[model samples]
Target: MIGRGSRRFGLGVLVGVLLGFAFALVGASPAAAHATLASTDPPQNQVLASAPDQITLTFTEAVRPVPARIKVIGPDRSVVNGGSPTSNGTKLVIPLGRDAGKGTYLVTFRVISADSHPIGGSFVFHVGAPSIDPPQEGEAAVTKADPAVVWALGAVRYLGYVGLVLLIGPMLFLARLWPARLSRRVPAKLVATGLGLLAFSTVAEMYLQGPYTAGTGLFGADADAIMNALGGSYGTTHTVRLGVLAAIAVLLRPFVRPQGPSTIDLAVVSFFAVVGLGTWPLSGHAGVSPAPAVSLVADAAHLASMGVWLGGLVVLVAVLLPKANARELGAILPVWSNWAMMSVIVLSLTGVAQAIIEVASFGPLFDTRYGRLVLAKVALLALVLVVAYFSRRLVLAPARKALVGAGGPADDDEELDEPPVKPLRRSILAELAITGVVLAVAAALVQTPPARSAADAPPEPYSVTLSTDLYRVRMELDPARTGGNSMHLYAYNPNGEPQTVVEWTVTATPADGSIDALDIPLLPVTADHAVAEPTFPTAGDWDIKITLRLSDIDQATVTQRVRIGD
Candidate 1:
């Protein structure tokens, strides 16, 4: 029999898996920013009569060229991209070396999107004809991002959001609704944590941008890479944000005092805050958006309102409501309620505007990943708003009583009752929890590709790895639908060395018995690799058999099943 704790653990795992499956079904896909390859010279899998002298790539949006991120491998497994790429207005031109002779060539490219995010892809083309042996899978070396690095980046972003809520909400409360009885320690620690998070995230982002854009591993950053990152527009904006945070640090003393920031200090800091906040939009999707000026301004307003409203909620629930007496509650709640009402209004209007610009069309709202995330955010926000409505009603009860003359003056401490306190606290807590989910959705929105761009792209390809006793084979099927598909197969020995194949045979059989097995003609591009174009006639599971003959006496056959879509 399982212990209680073990049952709970198993249930939790099951629930998590169910949630993950649900998200996957709803297309909570991996992030890819707006910049997409519009067209490439010798398009994907194009069979050219002769080798081209240069490769030209045109993107839907202009991207900052990182030549090191682009690799062109010739049939002989040698790098043939001449040198640095020359770029001009959404187009990148990479000259090819004379050695890029006949046979299949693979082009691997990665570039920084206009929003400072990295996007990458790989495609193959043939010159004269497919080679007898091409580059193997292991030799391609297109590394997936390190999981640790991905989590680190996400953590930093989450911390930044948390910090903003802590700093902005409490500061507003301290300035407007803070009572004398509340201890300063709680809010002070919160403010300090927020500032520290902002500062640290900025620095961490600067460091990570190099490795992220270079398509390298976590510790792949070097002096040149870091400097190059710092030199870019993205880096410059982050640097400015850091400076603003430092200034805020120096002014913390004035900010924390009972007598808040003086007129000049307030103005100076407000200006810095605006400039610093603007940097976020400058380096994000908003900056690259159509009608960027409008989008940027709207996004900034949206962020500011989120800080004011959410932060205020945090302060109310955590500090004021708990410690304050009836008198203090009466005095603080009304003013905070009014502030929150206005902030919510601003947030709604601005959020709608930004959504319009990003979503661009109604179809994508449910069809694209970004739009799905936006819908989730709106749903959560609506829940918070409902809770806020009840909290506001509770806050107004005292004032309503005073207006009807059942109580004495509204300011009288003795006449106040604590009846609504518990209910109001619970409502605020519920609102806060829902808003936390909204923040997560918002963070996901920033990382996801915009709906307008994602909706226009073609379906991504399918890849699989299969193995036999002697070797492992990696295969990629481009556009694995009921049509013509390009298949690339790479075979490697047990020791990770490329294994030569004297003979190659492949067959595909439908799993449902609706169709018989058919032999696929695979042309050997190299001793370790082969290429084939086969038309899948229907949508179903296909059992793929790859038989490789290493020598006259040695051969092995591996079979794997793959799904084909309509």
Candidate 2:
């Protein structure tokens, strides 16, 4: 009844809304891109005659700096800055070497971002003239999952996939043995349930994927950020997954049997189960390893096992209970027990593999938020296993006796009990609840980096001492930073006389290979120690190598920096 133009307008509005939601989901996380240098004043592929007065490197967003560092290679790969890096806001300044040569020089730098992400980059620039240079150790950003988050997401994603697979896979397998009992229409309905869930999850995941990949929610990212994610490998994998899932839906007819099981039924169930497993590799975890296929396989096993366990339970409650007579249920229960046990064993093995791959140590289990959640999930899983064990050992094992009204005359049957069924049903409900919580935790963990890796992390804290005739100078940098600009440095003297510092020369460079120096001022806060405000240019570990001159023979050099900046 609507006009063509009006229909078109409504369609257009729907399309726009879909696109907007899609963008918002992907646009949420600023942390998704992983901090890296966007461009520099000197430029990576560029050459210049004279060194720029200052160097500035831009990134996708604001980043925190660890000691803010930069190193001039001097065409000889030797450190040209007097001692170590210093900072000046977003610009990293390295002091020019007095006797520097005239060839192309490589700049390398590292820093930490405000978001606690590590950022590093490098560029090549010539001093005398502009000329092409082979790409220097090209700038790159490093990312690692927080251990707790890795295991958290890993556990949840697999559990959800397993539930779906178990829910549908067996209908194909079971239909062949008991045609009437399996029913003509249940397979279709089961497949439909999976398809519906998969569809909803895919849509939801796409929205959350942006935040998951971006490392923040919808409020944190911009249009360019979303566009960038779409243009990367992350986007490519998701597209392939969508295609695979769509194919599964089209080929789903085999899974929903009309009466008997066919080769098509068997093949489709396996294919869809494998499709469910596909999520792990497509997740941020897959690209992390050198062997992508191996990681994918491990993840697949984890998902397949989960599908058999959780999905089977769902099917038992929603459809199987009402349809099956006590005799049929007695037969089905034992077979399900075997399948559930096999799944539990496989799940345990794969879960360990995944945990080892993602979590380096057990400390995070208690220390990190993600780890704590993972522990909670494990406790819940244990409870599920206990329920399963009791259900199998105490209730279902005595199958002939548990049934109320068998058609055949039974001479050796024992007295039956129905109260155990109540407990079994309750346990299943609890299992489903646990699985749901696991999924939510997974959503959060996908954004965090592992806590163990050294790439973007600061070195563990230790002590350094620089001694002179008048005093012994000692400074301590925490090595592991807890939060915002909490860097502490201590100075002391052995002599009773207060040491007066006439001048302090401070120069810093960014890890991204950015700059030279700014004319900085220094004021004395104490007779022996002077307080100087340093503006770090980038994020990551910064090498703070400083020399303190008390007198001609009374000078000391101290170098220290923990993780700093964003």
Pick by TM-score: which candidate is best? 1
Which runs of model 2 end up more than 4 angstroms from their true locations?
Answer: 1-179, 182-187, 211-223, 290-294, 405-419, 454-456, 459-566
Per-residue CA lDDT of model 2 for 32-71, tens digit only, reads 2324455567754343556654555665434433322355
Q: What is the C-alpha lDDT of each candidate?
A: 0.75, 0.51
Question: lDDT tens string, model 1, 104-165?
Answer: 79888777778877777777777765554556444666655566666667677777787788
Best by lDDT: 1
Q: Residue 442 error for model 2, in Å?
A: 3.7
Candidate 2 contains a number of clashing pairs equal to: 46
Q: What C-alpha lDDT, on a 0 to 100 scale, does residue 516 get in candidate 2?
A: 57
Q: How far is each candidate from the true structure, as Cα RMSD in Å?
A: 9.8, 17.6
Estimate the TM-score of every prediction.
0.74, 0.55
